[model samples]
Every structure is written in C-alpha cells, then in structure tokens.
Target: MLKIIIAEAELEPMPRSLRSLPVMKKKYGRKDVVLLDSNYHHTSMQTLPDAYRRGRPDIVHVCLLNALESPLNKDGGLEVYVHTRNDKVIYIDPSWKVPKSYNRFVGLMEQLFSTRRITAGDTELLRMVNKTLPDLITEVSSGMPVKVMHYEGAPYEPDPDEVLVIGGFPHGDFVSDLPFSRFSIHGEELVAWAVLNHVVYGAHGT
Candidate 1:
C-alpha cells in the first residue's frame, strides 16, 4: 500500500480546496494517508519524530505554501522519499528568464530602476496587484512584516483595504503625489508584481 504524509502549517487558513487533499487521495486507492496541520503543536518539525515512530510513511510531502523558503531545515529527519513544491520560494537565477505574465510596465521599472524606486499603474498590473492584496494584509498584520519586506523593501504601509504595499516617496520628490513601490522578480507573476509594486488596484472588501 502506498502511504503518503502531507505536512503543512495551518489548514484552516489554507483554501478549502487545498485542504481536501486527503479526501481526494481516498478516491484513487486504499492507503494510509495522513494530513498533518502544524498549528496543533508549538513546532511543526517536532511532530515528525512521533509520527515517524508510529509508522514510517512511504512518501513525505511538505505542502506549506512557502516551505522551501522556510528557515527550518528538513535534512536531519527520517530518510524517506521527500518532495516539495519549488514555486513557494522566490530566488533570482540568471539562467531563467522572467515569466511574461507579469506587467510589462512593472517589469521595465524593476529592470531599469532599483527596487527602492519602482511603481505601477497599467490595467493588467493593477489586476495582478489586486489579486494578492488580501493575503499580504493577513501576513503583515500577523507580525511577519519581514515577509512583506522580502517582496518589496523595508517599511511598508497597509492601505485602507488592509493590503500591504510599499510606502515611500518617489525620486526624493517630497511634494510629488507619486507613491514609491518596489517589486522583486520572484514568485508568481501576479503575486510578484503586487509585492514589488506596492499597490493593489483590484483588492476590495479585503
């Protein structure tokens, strides 16, 4: 029988669709599948030791949204098949070209200007930004402001909608109405644009 262990941080916060993995697995075959939510304990990795002793799973998959980029290490535990989604982490690699789904205006700004001096206003750019705003708001308010900084830069402001965006004045122009936003070349195109640009145009009721 194939046994799969799926580990993630918080099941409630994740979308119900994603949380239904165990139910989906039952449809395929008969196996011992465990979906573990880390929030039940103080430390997620701590649960692994006990879980391992109970039964060694055939395949272990960590499903946290940003597990790959997490500071925690998965090196010392039980030796078994381990797989993680690479999309969670964002790192710049010269060999890979930036995806084209990103806003052209925002992309140009990042390439031409430093992260500290970037902004966006195009229709598509706004749409992408709006999509990621709510998540950013929850993250920032949760005391993980550094995550917000990871996308943009230091110091951010959450708009009335609770969407966190870059907060600064552009080009040393104290009087200029233009707001300073930053964008990094990482993650999904839409999410990357929202974080780096410091603006969420479409996010409403968030």
Candidate 2:
C-alpha cells in the first residue's frame, strides 16, 4: 500500500486565545471546539505566531477529498493520514466519503475534534489520536522507504509500498524536523492538494 502522511496540517479547533474574538464568538458561538479557518477568521489569526502558515483547514479538506476519491484508494492501494500542527493525527478509513461542501467539511472536522471519533454504524470512519509525525511514520511505514515531498528535492518516481509525507499547511517550511528522503515532481512549489492529485493519479496510471 502507498501510505501517505499529510504532516503538520493546519487543521485544528479554535485556539483558546482566539476563542474570545468577536468574529469567532459570533460565528461559532460557545462551542467548546470550533474548526479554525483562515477564510472565516483571518483577522483573528494575524495576531498568532506563524500566522501566515496557520488557520488553513481548507488545505486539509482538499487534500482529503482528492486522496479519498482517487482510483488508487478505491483499489485498496492507498492509505492516508492527516497529522496536524498540534501533534494530533487523524486516521482515515479509505471508504469514508469526504463531504463535498466545504462548510459541511468544517462542521465534520469540528465534530471529530470534539468527539475524537466518527463512526459509521459499527465501523469507525475517522478518529483522532495524539501522535507526532515521526511516531505516526514509524507505526505506518513498516520498513518501507519514507519520502517527503518538496520542490527542491531529488527527482520523483512512483515506488510501491512506500510511505510519502506531504505538507498540509498553506505556506512556509515544516515545523517539525522530518528525517526522510525528500523528492520532487516539480521544480516550482505546488499547492498540497495539487501535488497530491499529481502523485495519486501518477501512481494510479489513470
């Protein structure tokens, strides 16, 4: 299986600091956990550190949608995980159909963060665990080669059963030190979802 880890994703609930903001309180109300979205909370995020790279749940949403809908996943050849900036890892079931609506997607994420799991009857479709990126890699890699996607790295080629790490934030370098081979499909920077699509379809040969 081609396991993928979207490391340092910007997906998270509204931080405690931002919870009291007028915009947040007005939009999300008194919910204990609300998904932090740059589109909806841009002004509030500016005061936070590394603001440019934060508050982008849309990136994660797009990446998940692209990965889960790909032919490779349907064929049982792909596995995906989302590792957030807060050191939370989201385990995804390949059969889970991500909500197409961005608003609904955000709601689902808020619920997941609040409840820690989403189940479809008896099967768990999504679950959040407290895990660092490196730990997640070690658990899922299982001796397969680990590759990090970067524009300045070595030329890329599809390798079966390898674990790939792609940045899930909108901008800036990874916050964690990823000790893995970096590979590139393009010389210029591409958005996370775009790179994911290219890699998934390229691997799927479709």
Candidate 3:
C-alpha cells in the first residue's frame, strides 16, 4: 500500500489578509491566476513563482484528483492526507466527488477555517485532525520508516512499510523533526502536481 502525505500545504480559500495587496487593473493577474476579490489586488509574491500563492490550493486539489482517479486508489493501494497552513489535517475521502468549478471548491474548503467542527462523510473530505505536523507524521509512520521527497536526496524508490511525505508548499523546503529518508527523483524542482503524478505512478508500478 502507498500512502501519500502533503505536508504544510498552502491550500486555502481567499484570505482576508490578501485584501491588503495592491489592486491591479486586470481580472486575472499577469500570471493567469485568478484575483481573489473585488479589489483585484495582488501581493508582490503573486508575480513570483507562485501567483497569488494560489498554486498550493490548486496543487493540493489536483493531487487528490489524480490520486483518487488512479487505479491504485481503486484497489485500496492508495491513501491521502493533506496538512494545511492553518494547522489542519484533512484525511481526504477517496470516494469524495471533487468540485469541478472554482466557486464550489472554495465553498468546500472554507468550512475548514471555522471554529466549529464540520460533520460530513463521503462529501466533505476535510476531516479535522487536531494533530500537529510532527505528531501526525509520527502516527502515520506506524513503526515504519518515513520517506521524504527532497530535491537534495537520491531518486525515489518504493519500500514496504514506508509512507512518502511530499512538500505541499509552493515555496520553501520542509523543516521538521520527523525522521525521514530523503530522496529525489529529479534534480530540478517539479510542481507539486507533477511530483504527485510521478510518485503515485512510480509507486503503483512497484
């Protein structure tokens, strides 16, 4: 079985903090990413590698989409956990229907921000896990070695009793206490979704 963890994912609904950015004269920014609200504002970093910091939400979303759609997921060969920026762990339901539209997807994810716990089953994939990143990784390790997808390490190789931790953040490397065997599939940085595809496909073959 192959389980995938997206750690410290930047995925989120439009944050009110984004209201502080300078408004541009376009609906979508120069990067072709959506502007959050009526202000049409974009942060300075928005023009950088990650536009509006929007890639994370989309990255997390597409990762699940591909994972669930994979043959591995159907045969119980795959499981997914997404740990978000606000310190929430969403154990995604493999059976959940992913929203095809941006607005609907926003509605689904916005629930995670509330102080109240959401009650849902196959529909709401966001299962509120109160565990922090280190604890969550420890629990998932389950007396097995944890494999981290790091650009600095060697190419990835699947192992029995191993869980792979991939970076979910658009920028920055993972800095944590959990023990992991770092490995790399490629020298350059691949987008989160691309990395997910490679890992899932590679693991499925072994």
Candidate 4:
C-alpha cells in the first residue's frame, strides 16, 4: 500500500477550500492508497451541534470524497486520517459512501460537520484516531519507511512499502527535523495537485 501524508493542508471552509475537493478527488483518490490529512485547520470538534454553523475543516470533506471514489479501496479498504491543527486526529472508514451529486454532497457535508460522523444505515465513518505522527514520522511506519517529497536530493524511487509525505499548502518548506529521505521529482516547485499526481503515479505505476 502507498501511504501518503498531505501535511499542512488548509482546511478552511471557504469557497476555495470547498472547490479543492473536486480537484483533489479527481487526482489522488485512488486504490491502494492512504492519504493522511495532517495538521488541517478546522472547526472545533467539540462544537458538534454548531459544527457547520461555523465551518468545517474542508480537507476532511476533500479526503473522504477522494477515498470514496478510489478504485483501490475495494477489498482491504483504505485507512485514511485527518489530523487537525489543534492536534485532534480522526480516521475515516474507507467504505463510507459519499453522495455523488454536488447538491447532495453539500448536504452530506453539512450533516457530517454537525453530527461529527457519517452513517449509511448502521455503518459509522468518522472515527477518532489516536496514533500520532511523531516528527510527522517515526511511528505508524510499520515497514513503510517514510519519504519526504522535495525539489532537491536524489530522484524519487517508488517502493511498495514506503510512505510519501507532501506539503498540501500553497507554498512553504517543511519545518526542520524531518527524519526521512527527501527527494524532488521536479526541478522547480509544482502546485499541490501537480505534485500529488506525479508522486502517486510514480509510486503506484498507473
């Protein structure tokens, strides 16, 4: 499996953030993958009844939409995560069915934000995850040695048991103290989606 961390993704519930879902879902939403939404800014989880009354961390909506449409999430299922800026982490059940139509999608998101969960009949989708990404790495590796995606260092050599970490922000360098290898797949910086597509394709070979 290819484990990817979309670190520092802005989850502001603005129009831009909401629109980002379709774009991200079109790209990184794939089978055999786990995309972690790390350090996203979102509405306070404790404020349940008024969740959407504020604004949700749209990255959760985007990532869940991506995973619901992923082809590789068929059998074993994909374990995806959302790490909020406030340090709260939740794992989304991959089998959660996302509404397909845009109107329904919006409504569904509202319900999820307000209730803090996803339910299709008896199934629950939003699960609070406890594992932390130390230095954004170290543990949760479980044989998948993590790699930092950069624009420098050696070329990216994809491995089945490796975790790929990429910045989801518009522009910024990673904070110091990344303990894994860093390599660039391009000479210059690419937009988040471009980089996302390139890296996943390189790793999954399709």
Candidate 5:
C-alpha cells in the first residue's frame, strides 16, 4: 500500500471535499490516501522536524499557487508542484513559466478585454449590479423627470463549479488557496463540480 500525504498551506480550514478523502478511499479499496495539514508560518515549520521524523514521503505533493516562485529543496525526496492556471486547469510544472496553452488563454483574455466596448466603471457595475436598468427615457417622454445612464459592459459568466477560496487573518493578510494537484487537477469548474457530484450521488458506485 502506497502512503500518500497531502500538505497544504494552512490558510483556511481544510476543505470538506479534501477532508473526506480518507473515508472515500476506505469505502472503495484505496487504503493508501492520507490528508495532512500544514501552514507556511514559522510555527508550522517547528512541527515539521518531528512530523516526518520516522521516514520521508514516497511522494511529497505541494498544493500551492506558485511553488517554484521560491523553489523548494527536499533532500532526496520526490517533490511535485501544482498550480491552477488562469483558465482554471491544474498545471504541474517543475519551473515557473506557465505552459503554452495557458499563454494562449491569457492572450484570448487580453484580446477580449481590449475589444470590450465599455468603460471601467460600467464594467465594474456589470459585475456588481444584478438587475436590469429601468428605462428612464420612457419616463422622460411621459413628462416625468428622469435620469438616463448608459452602462456599457459585457455580462459576467463565471464557471459554475468555480469555488472561491478566501483566506484572511485577524490583521489583514489574506490569500486564495486553489486546488492544484497532479492526482486530480484539470478542467474548469465543470470538472470539480462533476467530481463533487459523483462523490455525492455515486458514493457507492465503483
């Protein structure tokens, strides 16, 4: 049986989906998955010297945004870095540069933003306001005082399975922890939502 330990930056509480991995494995037949939690603070590092004192991990999966931003050196240990690309796909790379496909996605976003026919204020409103604006011109034509405002902005279509991970301390430090793992890291929210749906509906299914 392969022993796998997942270590993540202790930002927020462990996600429920990730917390349930051990149960899922036991119910199925994979008795090798283990979930571990760790923060990037100094206190967390103090616990590390004794956490894995007995033996090193077969696979040390680091679930962080930019692991290579500050390359890690784990003597003789196999380390993997995973991150979610701007397009929401999990990318496992040993270096800092994003893949060619991610670059293409960024290019597409840039083109879309450049061609957008709206001002910054309107764009911000489009995301903030949820209701359609009232027709002020009709009221003005009816001899009633009315104000007309043109909010030109494209509609926001967020991915359905998109999960926003917000983290903040009592002071002001904050971070958004994303899922980026080789074992399961791909697709947009559709993939994650599908996996959650499966876990919910097909828990008994092999």
Candidate 6:
C-alpha cells in the first residue's frame, strides 16, 4: 500500500474570534461551525496569526480529490489521511467519493468538523481524531519508512507500503518540523494537489 499523509493541512472550523465578525455571521448565520476558507473570509483572517498560511481548506480539498480518484486508489494500493494544522487527523475511507463541487466539499468538511464523523448508513466514510501529526504517523506507518515530499530534499523513489507525507498548505512551510526524510520529484514548487498527483502516478510507475 502507498499511504499518503496530507500533513499540516490548513483545514479547520471557524475560530470563535472570527465567528463574531459581521461578514462571517452574514455568510454563515446561526451556524456554530463552518469551514474556515480564505477565499470567503480573507479580510477576517488577516488579524489571525500566520494568516497567509491559514484558512486554506481549498488546498486540502483539491489534494483529497486527486488522491481519491487516482489510479493507485482505484486499484486499492493507496491509503489517504489528512493531518490538519490544528493537530486533528482525518481518516478517509478508500471508497468514499469526494464531492467535485468546491462548495459542497466545504459543506461536507464543515459537517465533519461539527460531528467528527461522516457515515454512510453504518460504515463511516470520514472520521476525525484528536491526535498530533507525529502520533498519527507513528500509528499508521507501523515499521514502514516514513518520507515527506519536499523540493529541497533528495530525489523521490517509490517504495511499497511506505508512508509519504505531503504539505497541505498553499505557500508556506509546515508549522511542525517533521523528522522524516524528505524527497522531491519536481524541480520547482507545485501546488499540493499537483504534487499529490505526481506521487500517485509515480507509485504506479506511470
């Protein structure tokens, strides 16, 4: 299996501080929780710390869409996880179909944030756990070598069952320093979804 971890993803529920903003309230009336989106709340986010890198759930959205639809995933050779900036880990079922519409995807994520899990009848399609990125890595990787995708790192080579970590933010570096070795397939900086697609294709030797 090729296990991919979208680490330090900028995905989270709206903070209490932002909830009071008239723009936020106007956009999301009476909703106690909603996905923090920079595209929709850019002005409100400027006051927050590390504002440039936060409120980018769209990064995670595109990454998930690519990973879940890739050839590796269809062949049951891929496993995907999302580790949010807030230290929350999202577990994705291989069979779950991600919504193609960005708005719908955001809504699903908001629901997941509020309820902590999305269920299809009895089988859970998505679930969130309160765990740090390192802890989650330790659990999923077992004894497999863990590698992170980085442009400055060594050239990447695909290894079966290896845990691959990709940054899920738009432009900045990861907030948490990961100890794993870093590898890169591309020479220049690419978006999270582009890198994810590269990894997926490389895994299948395509």
lDDT winner: 2
Q: Residue 171 lDDT in model 5? A: 18
Score residue 129 of candidate 1 by CA lDDT. Answer: 17
Among all windows of 10 consecutive residues in model 3, the one with the lowest summed lDDT is 32-41
Look at candidate 6 and tell me the lDDT of residue 7: 93
Q: In terms of lDDT, which candidate is stronger, 5 or 6?
A: 6
TM-score of 3: 0.76
The root-mean-square deviation over C-alpha atoms between each candidate and the true structure, in angstroms, is: 21.1, 1.3, 5.6, 10.9, 22.7, 1.3
* lDDT over C-alpha atoms for residue 92 of model 6: 96
Model 4: lDDT equals: 0.52
Give all TM-scores, in the order shown.
0.17, 0.96, 0.76, 0.59, 0.15, 0.96
Residue 116: error of model 4 in Å?
4.2
Q: How close is candidate 1 to the true structure, as a TM-score?
A: 0.17
lDDT of 4 by residue, 1-206 (tens): 66666654443223334334654446435322212222331332222332322232343455555654555455442344554433335455667676656446555544544456666678787654344445445554676777888888678877756677766455456544577788778888776556555655454433
As for lDDT, the candidate ahead, 3 or 4, is 3
A best-first ranking of the candidates according to their lDDT comes to 2, 6, 3, 4, 1, 5
Q: Give the TM-score (vs. native) of candidate 6.
A: 0.96
lDDT of 1 by residue, 1-206 (tens): 01111211011122234335565345424323223333232233343433322211111111111222222212211111111121111111112222333234223323322222222442121111111223333333454222222333444443332222321111111121323343343432232223322232222222
1-206: candidate 6 lDDT, tens digit per residue = 88999999999988899999887788789986888888888888899998888898888888888889888899999999999978999999999999999999988998998899999998899999999988998999999999989888899988866999899888878768688888988788888888888878888843
State, as a TM-score between 0 and 1, how close model 4 is to the true structure.
Answer: 0.59
Q: How do the residues 109-191 of candidate 5 rate in per-residue lDDT, one tens digit apiece?
A: 23333332222442321111111112211211244222110112122222212222211111121123322212222232222
Q: Give the whole-model CA lDDT for all candidates, comma-separated.
A: 0.25, 0.89, 0.67, 0.52, 0.23, 0.88
For candidate 2, list the clashing residue pairs, or say none.
none
As a TM-score, model 2 comes out at 0.96
